[model samples]
Target chain A: MTPVAPLMLLLLRVTSPCDTGTRVVLVPFERLALPSADARELEEATRRAVAAMPDACLESREDTLARLRGSGDALAACGDAECRSAQASALGASKLVRGVALGVGGKRSVALTVTDARGTEARAQFEAPATAPGEADARAKKALEQVWSPRTTARATREPQGSRMLPKVLWGAGGAALLAGVGFGLASRSTESKLSKNGGECATAGESFAACFSSQLRKGRNQARTSNVLLGVGALLGAGGAVSFIWELP
Target chain B: MPLPLRRTLTLGVLLLASSAASAGPAQVHYALIVASNTGTEKSQAPLNYADDDGARYYELFAPRSREVVLLSVLDAETQALHPGLAAKTRPPTRPAMEAALTRLNARMAEDRVKGDVPVLTFVFVGHGKRGAAGEGAVSLLDGPLTRTDLYARVIAPSKASFLQLIVDACDSYFFVHSRGALPVGPAYAEAVKGLLSDRALARYPQVGVVLSTSSERESHEWSAIRSGVFSHLVRSALSGAGDVNGDGKVDYAELRAFVAAASQGIDDVRGQPDVFIQPPAQDRAFALTDLKDVSSLGYLLVPTGLSGRLWVEDARGIRLVELHKERERPLVVSLPVGKGYYLRSRGREATFSITRASEVVEAGGLPWHDVSVASRGAAQDAMRDKLFSVPFGPRFYQGYMASLGIPQPVDEAEADAALVP
Candidate 1:
């Protein structure tokens, strides 16, 4: 039997704008029969995610290419008719919403070369079945970095409004950080509860550290005090991160 | 019944023709049946019994409103009474049942379906359960077949010299399990070949047999309209529907198909009947042709010249012996010892046997002796093959076209190879 080639990258882009400037989206398309079948499901998933973007102007070539390339809206042709039409089509908004979303679910086995026709540049291939949610975003970010790298003088002709990083990237990152913080806080709280319950018992149970700490000597009390302070500090940090995300919401 | 009779007669004729055209009349076939039912259960009141080949198969059922009937046509085209057997529709009594069984055994011992015939068949039908000693157990009757009594009376006495037994029972194979783990597929076929080995059959070779289980041991719910497990299988196998091979007759090999098809209603448990031939005391009578009506009279010299043959021939175009002339004379022929011979005669009926008399020939010089009168069809078949041609060339082939004696064209080759000087 032939071993399958490992995935190098996976790009998952979403355009939902319900609470924040950008949504930290998921691109779980690894449960299909094969790559081709996966692509079909992925396309549907992407369309649904994009159409759900709240308050975001839909565009075709402009927004999609910009998001994929990570170009800011300031660089896009704001009043150009051709650019507007292209962008609208890319975002799948000019016509009535098809209401149907393309769904993709399968493992991508090999590296696929996706090229931008207008830019005449070969984009990096992202291996699917990404290791984790962050891994997929990391790959997408890397691909964008490659496209807009300072070393590369040439850029794609069409730039859309939705993909402009000034608002979207900041918002997406802020939300992801907020979720991560809340997750950490919840985890810490649970751990603290467990620790408190065991604190007194541990000393009586003859556990060396707990016994020594439970003696209530000035030194041991100081050590416990320090640990509590650290936990409090961590909680504070988590709250601050959550507030920053709320501040970034559009 | 009429159709079956016509078919039987036609088959008789065809067999005679094929034998005469093929090799000698020595085609070894057999039937082995194991019946174990005393009809003691209330639901299984009456037991129906028939002796085929040398084995007695019992079909047991409840007899209440009506009398049970047993209609049988033996291999010789003769109607015989089933002495000690009781049908479900008949009254139940040990004495009556024993008497019937005794009479059947007596008849079988008294007469024999002699000669080298093309094929032998045995069929039995009776009420049976799915498994042994379990809820929803399988049985031929509501009760059980006593193994000891069966072995002593039915099995030992009437074992067909060369015939195959076609059995239809739900848990019929429960006994084989007592014997050990059966090899996959059909154990019956292997057992048959093993039992009737050329060496064994040469010494014996009575008849070939096949049995089919209508229902499995775990299944086979009692059915008022449908026959018992054994009867169901027998009927289906004979209907040509179960004929896996294109051969006109459903031989032992086709039995698996019957068993498989019948297994649907018969739970997961499967049963295969036993088949093998018994050693004959003398060379089996093989009917080369069927001389019907006046022909039979003429062939047997029954004061009617309409049918039958004066003599049977061997491979060398040599007349083996005059048949149907008067008495049952043993026509002996000289053959290499330890080899098999195909016996054929005017009737399509035939069997095979080994030469124990140091030579292939009977006590007399010829290879065959005839005791029964022949029909017209039987005579034609005999004339085709029995009229021998040359020493060793293709006389057998010519005889094959005519369809007369045994020693088929193929067998001649085998015989020549097996011949010991």
Candidate 2:
């Protein structure tokens, strides 16, 4: 064999095992006195829906039953979420799907529950006329799709690039303004210290000392005012940025 | 056994005994809540609801605390409004406060001697200002209680394992930390360094602080709630609504997030109050209130599937807790069990009752009915419509924690494990 052929073969072998997406097992739907055929149809529809998920691989009913039999778990007895989750973990599956199918009045109703290994569950219900098994299948598929839809898609659509970047821009501006305010504040403090060190020498000394002191006082006042203004603006901007950033988070 | 092995076991037992001794006895909470409407200067406008706020705080903490002291001079109007509360209060003067502090210190010392750890909660709700030298002080009936006076009198002589200081006033940030030329947020480490450098509070490593406004802005009182807005929110938070993670404890970070989320929808910039919170440097998880210690309050469960901004109003029209909820995570807010409360949304309200302590009233089970618009003034309506409009849930809490770089107080794995049940 060529060198490239062996490399490609090795790559394929490495990735084939990892390509088996999240393992999902659909347990038989419990029938509340409903016809077994109808219950089987609803279960088949749900299996199709679960298999249709892009990142999910549905375990075959035969394989799931064999695994349960091997584990000494009766297929009809595993009803609650806890039991289903345990069964799914035993079968090396990450997700478990189960439901109850009942005939209410003239309508066939099904309530499905999907439980992951972490025990986070999502539930949905669908109802259709008892005579129309095809309608019931469609409704079950729709309900299963609704229940299995990922929540992250909604969150991803809530934030856009421009809105996400605005907070960062505001934060940058706020930091710059705060730095400038600190500089001015330090200068003002230095001027005040120098004035204090003079110790009223301007009052007893010549006109030069008095003029110098007055100029220093005016400069310090201006610097302090500017610093306060900048600091206030920076604080407002920073707070606005923080609030906006948090508000934009999905 | 050999002699060496026997000595090692004896040493280990002695070490365990000493550690247990250092842990001390069960902590008993003591509260000194002070409120003053009048300021040090005559020109300052008299507030109408400071005394009411103080009374509300006293009612909330008295049932849970070993002892609670209310320092306020209730006028005829306030006394008539809050009947029998005046008897429990003293004048909000310096001498009165000093004498109260002396008595409390003595009682705390006695408790320590009796092998009980004492925790002192100091709450001040009133007017405050910055002096010419940039020192912050809260006004009392006699005069301003300066920062130096507070450190020397309150922090220095306190015989408590932990001291919690809650202040709601103008420019209250400087009351705890000195303002330098460059203004910066008081992170826990920086605040600890400042406290240590001052040497005034050097011995107190278990001091926590919560302030209303971080800057020189004045915190406004809303007539809609008949109390100072910040104080009202703080009261709600401490009453157990601030326990965001359902951990039965309200930490400083949770309190800050609660206040921020509750006030995020205020339309006017001036009406929004900035919250400053710092837990003790030694313990970031230091809870401001433990719900298990409280007996007078019952919890209202806003369970999964009820989503939006909602507020609970008493029969007397006192709006207590306002929160925005998400559909996934559930929340439980503690309210006084004696009164009937209405959970109000924008156009609907559902009445609920908690007839016994620790009763959990499910809001989702209540029947919601349409509510007609009441003809209040424009300002009141504006304030009512704008508050607590933003939803607070896992998303907001995650964003807040990430932005502040605060470590998650609850382990994700543990939370998930707990959720499974």
DockQ of all predictions against the true structure, Cα-based: 0.00, 0.01
Residues B1-421, candidate 1: write the lDDT tens digits: 6743453454455445444554544342222223333333565543333223111222111000011123222222111322233222232223434454455444443334445432233333344443343212223322344433334444445534434334444433332122233333445334434433333223333433333333333223222111233443443333222332112233343333333333322222332233222223243322111111001010001111111223333232222222221111111112212233334444432333333211112211123444454344642333233322111112222343245232322321221111100
lDDT of each residue in B123-235, candidate 2, tens digit only: 99888887888788999998999988889899888997789999988777667666655245434223443454454344567888888763423337887777888887787
Q: How well is candidate 2 docked (DockQ)?
A: 0.01
Where model 1 places Cα greater than 4 Å from the true spot, the runs are A1-250, B1-124, B127-145, B175-218, B221-225, B261-421
**Total clashes for model 2:** 0
lDDT of each: 0.31, 0.69
- Tens digits of per-residue lDDT for model 1 on A1-250? 1010110011124353322222122211211112234443433434343344333333343333344334222112212223333332343332211111111111121111121212222223233342343343344334334432212312232332333344444455555655655555555555455446655334465648554544434444454555555555555555665666465442
Error in Å for residue B160 of model 1: 2.3
